[model samples]
Target: MDRPLRLIYCVFGLVTFCQASIIPCKDDDTKCLVSTANDIYPKIMSGDASIGAEILDPVWIDEIDGSVTILKYKFERCTVAGYKKCNITSLRIDAHNSKLKLNLMCPEVNLSGFYDINGRLIILPVQGNGNFSIDAYSYNINIDATYKIVKTDDRKEYITIKNFNFDANAEKGAKFQFDNLFNGRKDLADSVLKFANENSKEVLQEFQRPILSITYKIFIKNIYKFLKAMPMDNIFKQIYPKLHSFTCVRASLTPPTPCKADDTNCMMTIGKSVYKQVLTGDKSIGAERLEPMKFDEIDGGLTMLKFKMTDTTISGYEKCDMKDLKHDNAKMSFAMKITCPHLEVVGTYDMDGRLIVLPVQGKGKFSIIMDSYDLSLTVTYKIVKDDGGKEHLSIKTYQAEAEPIKGVKYEFQNLFNGKQDLANSVHKFANENWKEVTLQFQGPIIAATFKKLIKNTNKFLKAMPMDKVFL
Candidate 1:
């Protein structure tokens, strides 16, 4: 009797363990289904992916009259949407009457059948095809689906659609069928085809129900295969790398320590080596300064940096045509030349105790020699990072003062024949044109040049693995 009692207790424990393991398997299946549905349904609705069917053999046959009717139907290029032009709100397991809208084209449905005469059913084999289209407002569908877990022959579990049903309706004008059967009376055949087409709603309703069921079954099988192929634990590890402890390095301090405790007061020095590496590596900005960079720590997590470039030649090419200046009445046609031989910048930026967001404002002075008369300019600009992790620079204000310099001249052989007054007039006109042209080109050129700068800086900061760089 004691042996029998022990056997029964062991059996109960085994049953409980099996049931507990099955619970998690069920939960995982549910999660996989929901994730796949959320990812795939939108693509099908947007026409990015298509669902369709094709049948080649004859579908219907009549034995009494010796008549054979072959019907071929397909739903081609269908785009699904929500009811009343709204977006699909939700999709869930065991959901019923989920409304959907489909815009589809039914192209060239072929039919072959026998026609009846006044007294007898003639064996006049008719073959014809017609195209039909469904408008967005006219076609509407309601769907019901439920899923179940099944064990395969290999004892592996899978999720599959157990039941699926749908009903659809379309406007009368959306129905079309062809009848090129009668020997001589084409109009009568057309009338018959139209009549058949009018009642086609019922046929379509029956055909679509099974197609949806098959589609959902395929979807469920694919999702299960995908989940089994790659586990979720590996995916999460790939996205989020291991976080390591990092600290700021200061030359004045005894040694570097972790910044996790007091990140707000930590100051990571941007030494000359880092500055030279970043500036020299970026070919787009083409910045080379002989003097060492000056960095000052300021209040409110801000840093001030002063950069100077002497005897530097900045050259850029722009395709200039007469048509670009559409609003200008002068219609002056000459090559546009832009250059800056010397430039200086003083900027202040706040990192907000984080490496992600960098906001910078600066004032710059540059000398521009456009074709001839030397012009000195001062401008204020701001560099901002957008939500999509792209950096852009915009000029807020600009001041340009042009003056004629001795021995500095421009030669437009055809327009100005070396006349001093005429040359001066052209230079004056060019200076005025510079204002508008500068406004148009400055934003794009600066943005492109600074893109490499911003990217390299962000990479360097993040590479430090420090929580905060105070200045």
Candidate 2:
């Protein structure tokens, strides 16, 4: 036989025996099903074969007269004829065969004497210890099978095989104990071997149904075990990538509305009520505004969203202040202290944002961040999708500025502690030159603060799906 055929036979034989050791379904069993399917599918597609298991055991074949017990039946190889397809509904195995190396311990069976030339009578006793080989054939095997999710007695759901049945003809070829029993009688030995071969089909047919049934049970049990182990959510995601999108659309359309004549791109609308819940309830985009998120538009694979936000009280960064900052110039060298307790920015801004689906680019911003100085900010940001399909925000460009506000305190400490007059003079000068001071420090400080904010925002966006923001 060719190398590929040899390998196929070897794998088949091993898997046949190994199938007996399948365990019951467990909580995390889907991996085994997926792995087994993956392993089998490629080999089947490539016209190669691999063993799912290997085992050592004795097999017994019972007959009407007596039972033949194989002392050590070594499954040598198994090979199936080329098949086109296999699925949950049915499986077809063309004319397939397997080989076995058998060591038989056959007891002596008494036979009536036969007269030779009407002169001498000879009695025969069948017994033997010799190397034996057997070949099993399964012809035109067809199986009708179905897949189902069944709940076990323990209330756990498991994928299972259902309505399993098969049709096939089984035939066998065996090198019986002819050489040992009928030695020196070539004619008798030949006759005995022929009879065994011809009648072997009957014996094979007798056991074929039970064997196939057991094999199917073993395979099905393994599949059940695998499905039981895997989580349902993961299984759904693997089977249906757009399942979440379908769910989102369904949830949005509880009370369905009519689509407009020109609204071919509109998936669903987020009305005022749902928009409020989505913005306020979401921890990532804690948007607060009187206006609602209007109709979402999709153009050439890009999702555009328009929204307005105003007077948002976002918590977490309650206080940000800088103390003991020394500034040295040609006229003065003194430590400056500036603090803004409960720092926050309240502003009104509108967004015209577009989310590119294919390349996953996000553009446009309303007000990204604010401070107590009523200074609003807008940034160019991108939505990055990781390898695992999770999205995060990254700030590309930010506009930073600082405008002097009255009542803002500035404390200056002179180089010499006793120079109280100099310290007062320095403080007065700093207040008088507030615009220059603010311009000097505003870029670096805002840049640093925005960097930290972007990092935190990215993490928050990653934790929550971007679709939730639109919903």
Which candidate ranks first by lDDT, i.e. highest? Answer: 2
- After superposing candidate 2, which stretches have Cα over 4 Å from the reference? 1-130, 136-138, 144-148, 152-156, 162-167, 170-189, 206-218, 229-233, 237-471
Could you give candidate 1's per-residue lDDT for residues 6-50 as a string of tens digits?
Answer: 221111111111111111212224454334333333322221000
Candidate 2 residue-wise lDDT, 1-471, digit = tens: 232222222222212211221222222344443333334432222210011111111111111121223211111112121222332222122113222111111121111111111110112223332333334532335545444455667665434444556655432332223233334466765664566566765534442454445444544443343334332222222211211121111222243343332232232232223322333334334422212222122112101223233443333232433332221221111122333333332234333322111111212222222223423233333446777896543433333334445423443222124366654654465456655434322332344344444444344444544454322
How many clashing residue pairs, candidate 1?
0
Which segments of candidate 1 are over 4 A away from where they belong? Answer: 1-40, 44-137, 149-163, 171-173, 177-185, 197-200, 206-471
What pairs collide in candidate 2? 9-77, 9-78, 27-229, 28-229, 29-226, 29-229, 30-226, 30-230, 344-371
Predictions in order: lDDT: 0.30, 0.32
Clash numbers, per candidate: 0, 9
